[model samples]
Target: MDEVEVVVAHSERTTLRVGDVFLKVDADQSRLDVEVAAMGLAPIPTPEVLWRKPPALAIAAVPGTALGVLGEPSPASPAAWAAAGAAIRELHDAPLPPWTSRSVEEIRVDLDRECEWLITNDVLPADLIRYNREIAEIALRPWTPVFTHGDLQITHVFVDGDKVTGVIDWSEASRGDAMFDLAILTLGHEEHLADVIAGYGDGADRDVIRAWWSLRSLTASRWLTEHGFDPNTPGCEFDVLRTAFEAARG
Candidate 1:
């Protein structure tokens, strides 16, 4: 957006590329931007990318829009959500050899710390927290953790006509309880969220999945806050989490 042409690419990493060259900015808090571009040719799930000059980092020349329409509110029928579930199942099923595994014992090892987080932030709830823990222990009992999309949902899933074209944004991809991804996607505002998950080739527990999502609200809030990102910022689910936090208190 400076003298250089800038495009809003599907990526948020601040990168700059000129011709075959790439540029990256490594500043955390300087006059310039913090999310610098790094040259990467690795497999990514989005249509556009951000780049930088001199091939140092990835940069954006043109502001990019999502390749397909979103928020159209036209459920491609439960059939589409059903398909999306299959695609996600396959994705979750992929072996993440290079990635470390995740399990309840691993995440819960820090339970005392995670629980202290809610209390310290004044977002802790007694009944809700108790129920959340019980549900997690039960739900996570059946499924082994895997590398997940972390934020899979209707908005992040792109469909072309009836086919799922791409699963965008791997910024949050990591080893976690598979239920973590299922929790967010199957809940929220998607009208067909439940129907779709139920249609997965294998029956998945929905209530337990929802519990995983409810537990992460505070976890994400703390993670973002520490990283200097506000969860309540517009376009994010912070306010909705605020509602959940209050409901938990109730």
Candidate 2:
């Protein structure tokens, strides 16, 4: 928390620290299709498992001025979202696993399970359950088990010279539908979400992407709220997720 020149981030326990070595885990499960800059790849950075004991830790690679700069974009302006969208498209194109420990059906079900946690904890709007159910009904059918970032968000991506220089946090990386990745990137930035989606490869379906985005947004929001995280905190991902939920719904 003092003055330091370098910092490290842990995937399992986030809260970056100022130090030479960074730590992260593979979670309690498996992650695939993950890469790190050390592997000679750019535009996508995955955490390198440096220590896999007790609480897993990994070495992280990042670019200058990412997350620290850019802040949040005004969806009213297409330029920011446009570029971010393109970057995400490139990220989606990055390699990922074709399957995870769970199937697409099971993963889709997690959205409901996450929301239910919110309801059981009395942290979600009661109507959220039905709203999400409708979303699932429409979104669940088109899922294709393919490579996914598992958790994709603008924060995880880094840009340099108009190119995505790096992408971070791979514990969530796994095999799933591309829409899941799309959902993570465009959930709240819906105003510009279209621009981002438009920039994506022609292979993806918009309707499916929107549904999953909406579902994941709600699931992530409830998670933060339940954990007592400040929803309005600046740079707080929970608020971002909630915003994505609204955007996807709209």
| Per-candidate count of clashing residue pairs (backbone under 3 Å) | 40, 8
Candidate 2 residue 142 Cα shift, in angstroms, is: 4.4
| lDDT of candidate 2 over 1-250, digit per residue (tens) | 5454333223334434345345443444333224332233324444444544544444545553342221366322344445556655665566654435466577567876876776787764656555655665567674545555566666665555445555666656555666767766765555556766666747767767767755665556655555555444554444444544465579
- Candidate 1 Cα deviation (angstroms), residue 130: 3.9
What C-alpha RMSD separates each model from the true structure?
A: 7.1, 5.1
Residue 94 in model 1: lDDT: 67
Note the Cα lDDT for every prediction shown.
0.51, 0.55
Q: Tell me how far the alpha carbon of residue 227 in candidate 1 is from the true structure, in angstroms, after superposition.
A: 4.9
Span of ten consecutive residues with least summed lDDT in model 1: 33-42
- Against the true structure, candidate 1 has what lDDT? 0.51
**TM-score against native, each model:** 0.60, 0.68
**Distance (Å) between predicted and true CA of 174, model 1?**
5.0
